[model samples]
Target chain A: MASGGSGWRTLPPGGIIVEPGSSLRYKTGTWRVMRPIINQDKCVRCRMCWVYCPDAAIIETDEEYVDSKGRRWNRTYKVNYDYCKGCGICAEECPVNAIEMVPEVK
Target chain B: MMGSQPERFKSKFRGILDIPREERFVSGHRLCAGCPVGTVMRMLTKVAGKDSIIVNGTGCLEVSSTPYPYTSWMNPWIHVAFENTGAVASGVEAALKVLKAKGVLGKDVKVVAVAGDGGTFDIGLQSLSGMLERGHKVMYVLYDNEAYMNTGIQRSGATPWGAWTTTTPVGKKWKGEWRWKKDIMGIVLAHRVPYAATASPSHPMDMIRKFEKALYYTREGPTFVHVLIPCTTGWRFDPALSIKVARLAVETGIWVLYEVEKGKFRVTHKVRKRKPVREYLKLQGRFRHLTDDDIEYIQKIVDEEVDRINKMAGEEVIGPVEA
Candidate 1:
């Protein structure tokens, strides 16, 4: 199926993935036009967004954050733009309306 | 992850974030955006833990997760043909048994077999039947997205009645799929599986708990978990409303969350007053052609199913909606 250079013979033996979970190498961040932005100050860290995320785009970091309402969240959830498909489930499922889906600009 | 029984939830609602934080089913795969199975996969691999071997079938999860050189599976996995997921999984379980007996393997490595509705309810049914009948120690999970979603959303045995698909297109003469969705839970129960349950993507906690129960019962025999994952592409809904659609399935009494364990039937998520089926059908493009009478017919079936489960459970597990 190769156009010019190396053909199918160049692929690994048996097509076994030497590096497990190697799909991380192919970034899917470009698939989204609407990127979900998590407002740390408004987030309650209930992990509602994190749990519903299909892409595992919602990264749970060790970084702690205290919201504007004095709620201390042990971990912060950030959108890993690299693989986010911008499905808007995070924004829709967020109980506190902390996640806002804004259009991604080039 | 193995040996000990899964700690059951208490009176308090378990925190969704409190579970194991490891990302076993990592990102960068090719599953559709807002795909319900991705959420299920995250919870499933998280609950199953890393000390398990995942036996995936030729379905969407396999096609998307492992595209040639790249794979999203952090745990050991084997993707086999469409019709022999159970046979392959049984072989893997047998291999594990021999390894343990021979002192080559120490830790209790759980074998999890995952297949789509087509695999479980149709083509692979015989293989699955043999596995369950033989009492293999594998937690068989059927992700019922309701059709052959991997190959352009054709109607399968699991496709519910009155819903449109590529094979069962709605037209002047033909309605949607006339055949009722196959009762897989009933089939698994018939095989006398140690633990069997039906789960929905809307309830993650319930789904995770069911997965845990299935894992725990692997020591006894093969455990079957059937999860209703609303397909974003096939079901023809806004990808964002995936979870909502799943919830509507439960809320409308179309999908029941129950488990059959040691001959005892229990309803997990019970609805007090059920919504009209139209509320769920209206959201999806596939069911857009369903008329009022068509919806009424589906509603009758849903109501009867709710009552049937309630009768089977010997309690008013699902409360009826007073008109």
Candidate 2:
């Protein structure tokens, strides 16, 4: 949260951004396994959503969920599509059974 | 201004060899082909140069490089068990200090300890904590390859989330290594040592500079260098792509290049535009089970952590810092 040069360094706008064009040039390696799906309505406030994330992929908000933002409600949990591994733990760990596993499309 | 052109060129385009060549890890020992640690060890010793002593924890590097009579280390190096190198290095420093006090040993020799993630994060943490608290005049380098690669690929505390190690298999019931890597750097940085930097074999020259900073920054205080060394044997990657894989780590922001000196943080590699964590994870055999949504989830975390670090550096807040 600390801004200004004295405290911490910020990534310049272009800093550390991966170019989309470069993605396919190298081998995509292995990831063709499992996918994760989430149901927002059944989700509770339990932070279990944030704890088990290995890739640190879960996003939770403290604000109340509002429909006006067009984004999922605040305090509502959502997966950051950019980094989720779809391991299903988030769905599985949801105490309310709000998440489900779908077959990963090839 | 006229003289500035040649001077600027000399400084700007400096090659790596200008770094130094005092080898601590010698050649002709056993290490896996294309082991990332080998490259780190070579570059590290080059920076530490000629006058140094190393305390090696028992791991692939220690096991492979120092098999009995044959030693790959040219400098004065000792292999204590997996959990005691920090303590051992502390003793080395204390002994040198006592000897110096008694006018027995010269003050030229530097001391450093090399450890794996298993050694640093899980087993040797107590010793490391003690050394940092005591502030021994030594350097400790943790070659992080995620899991415990030396021990047939078991999961360590440093293994990333969603990674499939032998212990943390991905199955119908299980996803992968369940927990996140413990932030050892944050813990070490809290000690407020004279220097702490994360380097990668991908940036050999930058790595050399970090090592030099550690070796010479103080003859009487502790310093820690965490290097991201990719392991092919455990991660199941082509051995030849070790350097490339290491590069991907930085490029993708899964692993960052930065330093904290006296609590001032500076991220060296300007990622300019960040790479997705999936890009880094997808290259290795370990994360093969990850789905697109999974990749997105991981990307979110990587971005959050990066933002957290950058925020500490006072950079713009990007994503998921609350997590």
TM-score versus the correct structure, for each prediction = 0.94, 0.70
Q: What is the per-residue lDDT of model 1 for residues B1-323, given as tens digits with 9 covering 90 to 100?
A: 12456654332226675667788999999998999788999889999988999999889989999997789999998987999999999999999999999999999999999999998899999999999999999999999999999999999999988889999998898898999988888888998887899898788889988898888778889999998898889999888899999998898888888888777888999888888888999999988888888888888988898888888988887778647
Which structure among the candidates has the greatest lDDT? 1
The alpha-carbon deviation from the true structure for residue B275 of candidate 1, after best TM-score superposition, in angstroms, is 1.3
lDDT of 2 by residue, A1-106 (tens): 2235742254333232222112222221133145556666666555554533332345655667645335564466666555454444456456787777676776
Candidate 2 error regions (>4 Å) = A1-106, B1-14, B21-24, B316-323
Supply candidate 1's per-residue lDDT for B56: 94
- TM-scores of chain A across the candidates, in order, are 0.84, 0.55
Interface RMSD for each predicted structure: 0.8, 18.1
DockQ (Cα-based) per candidate? 0.74, 0.01
Cα deviation of B89 in candidate 2 (Å)?
0.6
